[model samples]
Each structure stands twice: as C-alpha cells, then as structure tokens.
Target: MNDIAAIPVWAIIPVSLLLIVGGSIVLIGALGLLRLPSFYQRIHGPAITVTLGAGCLLIASMIYFTVLQSRPVIHEIIISLFLLLTAPIVAMMIMRAAVYRDLRAGKKDAGAAAGGIYQFPEESE
Candidate 1:
C-alpha cells in the first residue's frame, strides 16, 4: 500500500530489524522446545520464549506501531501487562501438574528428576 511505502527508510529499517530479531527469538524457543529430550529440558523452552521472546516481540510491536502512528502508542503495554501477569502463573501450574502426575504415579525419583542441580534423596516410607 502507498501508506506502507511512505514510511521513512530509517523507521522501516529499525522496525524490520526488530521484527526479524523477535521472530528469530520465537523460532529458537520453539526449536528448543521440540529438540529437547526430557520434559524438564522442554519446560525451559516455553519459559524462555514467554519471558524473553515474547518481550522482544512485544517491544517490536510497540516500536512498529509507534513509528507508524508518529507517536508513542502504548496499547502494547496492556498486552504486555496481561502476559506478564499470566505467563509465570501458567508455567507454575503446568510444572505443578507435571510434578503431581509424577507423585501420583509413585515415582520415587520424581524429586531427583525435577532437581537439576542439587541432589534430592528419595524419601523412605
């Protein structure tokens, strides 16, 4: 469209760069999620995407819209706020569900499996 082309080259360049960087972040997150072998490893992928990748994309969106509107458009902040509010809660719930499932299955190694660094001994009952 004519309007799209009317954007100054400087604005276009930065916006395009932001979008590319944001997209790359998201792609890397998805690839990480898919390529990881264990659920614990996989959890990191989405968490990284949600925290970092989404932040990048949101910043890109904010920049693009601000450039397009010739002013600081803050609508993206609402979405960012919503995401910030919910993402961690959802991730925690998901991890809790996984742990609950493992516990329900009576896997004595659940704590050990979840603990990536410090070793947790299996409880004796």
Candidate 2:
C-alpha cells in the first residue's frame, strides 16, 4: 500500500531485520519445545526465548508504528512490560505444579531435581 511504500529505507531495514530475527527466535523456541527430551527442559526453551523473541517483535512494532504515524507509539511497551512480569511467574508456577504432581505421584527424583526445596508431606505409620 501507499503507507508502506512511504516508509523510508532506514526504518524499513530495521523493521525487516527485527521481524526476521524475532520470527527466527520464536521458531527456535518452538523447535526447542518439540526437540527437548523432558518437561523441565522443554519449559526452559519457550520460557526464555518467548520473552526475548516477543520483546524483539514488540520493539519492531513500536518502531514501525512510530515511524508510520510520525509519533511515539508506545502501546507495545505496556504489552512488553506485562509479558516480562508474567511470563516467568507463569513458567515458575507451571514448574511448581509439575513438581508437586510428581511428588504426589511418589517421584522422589522430582524433589531431588528441585534441589530438595519442596516440602514432602510426612507419612504416618
């Protein structure tokens, strides 16, 4: 469209590069989820990379919109902030749930893997 064509080369280049890099990062994270051998390992891939990849994509969006509208478009920052704050907490909660499930199922290795931090319920004789 005319709006896309009107964007200067400088802005276009960074936006394109950001898109490519962000897409690649997200792809890698997806691959990691599929290729990883265990749940613990799998969670790490997306947990780390999704944040970074989304950050890159959000930055790209901010830049593209700011350039297009000729104003400081900062909506992405709020999304980015929310992502930054919640993604890790969600990952941690999921991990804790998994560990608790494993412990409940009598998987001693899960507690060991968690560095003995989880309190196992006492068994009454």
> For this target, which candidate reaches the highest lDDT against the unseen true structure?
2
In order of appearance, the predictions have TM-scores of: 0.81, 0.91
For model 2, how does the per-residue alpha-carbon lDDT over 29-106 read when each residue is reduced to its tens digit? 999999998897899899999999999999999999999999999999999999999999999999999988988888
* Tens-digit per-residue lDDT, 1-125, candidate 1: 87687677877777777778878888988999999987767877887677666776787778777877889988888888888888878877887777767666876555455564323356789
- lDDT at residue 21 of model 2 (Cα atoms): 95
Quality of model 2 by C-alpha lDDT:
0.91
Separate clash counts for every candidate: 0, 0
Model 1 residue 91 distance off true place after TM-score fit, in angstroms = 0.9
Which parts of model 2 are misplaced by more than 4 Å? 116-124
Question: Candidate 1, overall lDDT?
Answer: 0.75
